[model samples]
Target: MATPNKENAPQHGTTGTAPLLLSRVAGNASAPEILIATMHGKEAVLAPALALLGFQVLLPVDYDTDALGTFSGDIRRPGTAFEAALEKARRACDATGVPRAVASEGSYRPSQSLFPGARNVELLAFVDRESGVEFVEYLTDVPTRFVKGRVPADPAAPETRALLAEIGWPAIRAMVVPNDPGEGVVLPEQVFKGIDHEAALAEAFRVCATHSDDGLVHLETDLRAHMNPTRMASVALVGTRLIERLRQEGYASAHPQFA
Candidate 1:
């Protein structure tokens, strides 16, 4: 959790003389409840910033957010990350019965702007349904530690184990899929997601190999925020950026002209 430091305001495009917006939010009753839509556990990642902003966060129950998209490619996300994030915020607000909502969406892929290597683009959206005000912020990190490769067919081979070890293996979650996997084909019998143990990892390679025509398994480090610490950090940083935007917006409301 970042302390409310005035030194951090200037870079966020706020004047030093402006009062702490979080303090004003904390004292105001008209604004408190906020709904955040995310299936995997990230309360700890998001809670700290919301706490500083004096928001009572709400989460949905048994939400089928995978209908939008999935990190494992089982569900193809349509349109841009911004579009998906806005929908998430609106739907979450409706579900939680809150006028204000926050939601985030992220994607991992090779970047043309940063490097040819994998990059993480995380975006957070804040919506005020009553006021029709929306704020969306995003951040991209280069070399996000996102990695993928095919697993060797021979489960007992040293190189197979080495490949797993290189991806942080049991320490981090690994997911397996056929190189040309289709949606709904990512069943536990074939896809072998969330593998975090040596035995499960070996089984995943064997299972996915048999399903693949080339007898190889596509192995990838799971980029889900809850599964990957690197992604979680990116999300947390985005949370800070969103809070800063909200703070700046709050500061502007103090003056009629800016408002």
Candidate 2:
């Protein structure tokens, strides 16, 4: 796939020594700063929870987390979800010289339950450099809007229309790829993501279908935190839980173990 466009990605770094507003949330001027390794607007959902512990959120400018993995299958994720999250947290600290960092990873799969659908599993990891400690929090069977289907190139077809309606297109966003990517790696031209409009979807279907051996396209929900509201909510839920866990462990009191 094409290299991620860093320029178009959201910028998160801030300048100066002035404390961020979140640092004052707990009325602590020296609130610890924690770098968030993300490019999908995750900091917004996680900041409030971290603020409870008098933690200030920091984001690295122009960092591309997609290199680790993507839901679209273009770049296969390495290792387990917890491992990926831990690596990202470490990478953030290494890149920005930040001693503390947090990162998250998400995965989706067919549900093995009685109901026939998919389930989302999200994991968050926090790393403290000084103490050489890493903490992981995760949630399984989280609610998701994930959906996938194989369809012909024709966007005007009834089946295509139905799938679009089911996914709530233009609102939830969608991604398109060749139904059969062949033995070789799928190229950037063969994948279309963040498609929200009918015209774009139609165009993506056409291009992706052209590359498929079966002359079909695979369409599914875009599960990125910024594109998918359902997944974002789940991230927030897990983030809240992580914060509560830290609180229960006496992190706010700076217990000797964590201190």
Candidate 3:
């Protein structure tokens, strides 16, 4: 991925000073903590926003978020994005014995508008077990580098190279699997993810083609938060929205009394 332009990054809050929202919640002797359920370093993108509200972001160890769902279709997501996110948040609390947690879920689909690419829908769920309150924030039609199609197992071919360029290969990662698999069961060996270099991409196409019935590989951009910069940006955007919603609901003002 291209280096993120730090100078142009969005500012979540003032540096070194507590925000007004933080002051409202400062009655508590200890800062409130919210666990972020993720294995893809989502806390880095989300933590700053919640920190603005005086929330100390926590990450659970050995959290397996992929059990909830995976972008590569190996494991199907169980429900709507909101449900998935809520479950992840709830599970995080249960695992870490924390009363509050947050989780993010993203869905991508072909754009139905004038645009020809994909659209990403990002959702963030915050659950406060202490208050028995759960809320979700989402942003739809977010931009993404997601692309998918079948191609022959030849990385040097013009069509293959064109497809790679379209997905911004070497910067954005790729995932490959056989275009057609019997019984819709894809084995671990047949699936190659996080392919960034040309050599790895070539090898993935070769391996997937061997498994494909028609000798075609199904290639797509890796949508993991750590793999896709665009998706990370979307997560940050939605996280900011979540913090805004919390402020609007006066969660800090209301919950500080209990703290």
Candidate 4:
């Protein structure tokens, strides 16, 4: 997904007292090609920022990144998020035949703070094989609207409907799965996703209950970046952070110490 054009140059907006990182444009002379390793349309958010620094952003396809892991629990993500981001970037570079690439990864977990039930930790990475430079930046959003809970078999019940309303269902897009596995269900058919309508909700609940030993359905917000607007915004913010760093520095940029 090509990022929508904003302006030729990125705006210098800083949230804190820190100076805007728009001191100098990067890769302008060489105009390096940047391949964004993302399957969830993240380029739509990142390209404009990289464009400001005169980097051409490209999106590559036919990558089995899910073999690495997924936001959903269906496949477990490997190593730390920083590791995952760099690995994804390397894979994207290999696939596109581009030495410079960008990648993003997001981690969702219950908030340890007092604000909300959950937090979104978004990470972005840039890899330049020519310079042997691999850098990453990360940000955490405590105001994230992540929540999950279990619903009874009958979603048509009044209390269940109220729960749906509280979770902002039919808009946020929910996923339903069995509360527990039955004796013979190697792979339960209760995993229904992208569910937003009341009709689909009822059906998912019925199937999950009928197939599960616990007779209950587990419902959750779909945390995929493309599926969740809040998460996608975080991805964009992190991309901007990467752009800021690139503008302010050269080959070496600030990143968490990795071993």
TM-score for each model: 0.76, 0.81, 0.81, 0.74
- For every candidate in turn, the CA RMSD to the true structure comes to 10.1, 6.6, 9.1, 10.4
lDDT of 2 by residue, 79-125 (tens): 76777899998877766666778899887754345224536677889
For candidate 3, lDDT tens digit of each residue in 1-259? 2222334232223323531111111112256767778888787777766655666555554468898977766777786777899999987776655678889998785334522453668889989888898999987777767888888789888878888889888788888989532137677677788999888888898888888879778888888989888888888888888988888766553466323
* All candidates in order of lDDT, best leading: 3, 2, 1, 4
lDDT of 1 by residue, 1-259 (tens): 2233233221211223432122111222343666666666555578656755666555554445677877777677777777888888787666544677777887676445533343667788888887788878987772345677766766567766776777776666888887744324455446577778767777777677777768877888877767777777777888888878887877233434223
Residue pair clashes in candidate 1: none
lDDT of 2 at 214: 88
Q: For candidate 2, what is the lDDT?
A: 0.72
Q: Number of clashes in every candidate structure?
A: 0, 0, 1, 0
Order the candidates by TM-score, highest first: 2, 3, 1, 4
Q: Taking the tens digit of each residue's C-alpha lDDT, what string does model 4 give over 1-259? A: 4433333433223323432222112334245567777767677788767766667555554345666766445556677777888999887665555778888877675334522443567789889877788899988772335667666778776767766676667666777777522112324254687787878887888777776657767777766666667777788877778987876655222222110
Q: Which ranges of candidate 4 are over 4 A from the true structure?
A: 1-30, 110-118, 180-190, 211-213, 251-259
Q: Each candidate's lDDT (Cα)?
A: 0.65, 0.72, 0.73, 0.64
**Cα lDDT for residue 145, model 3?**
71
lDDT of 1 at 19: 27
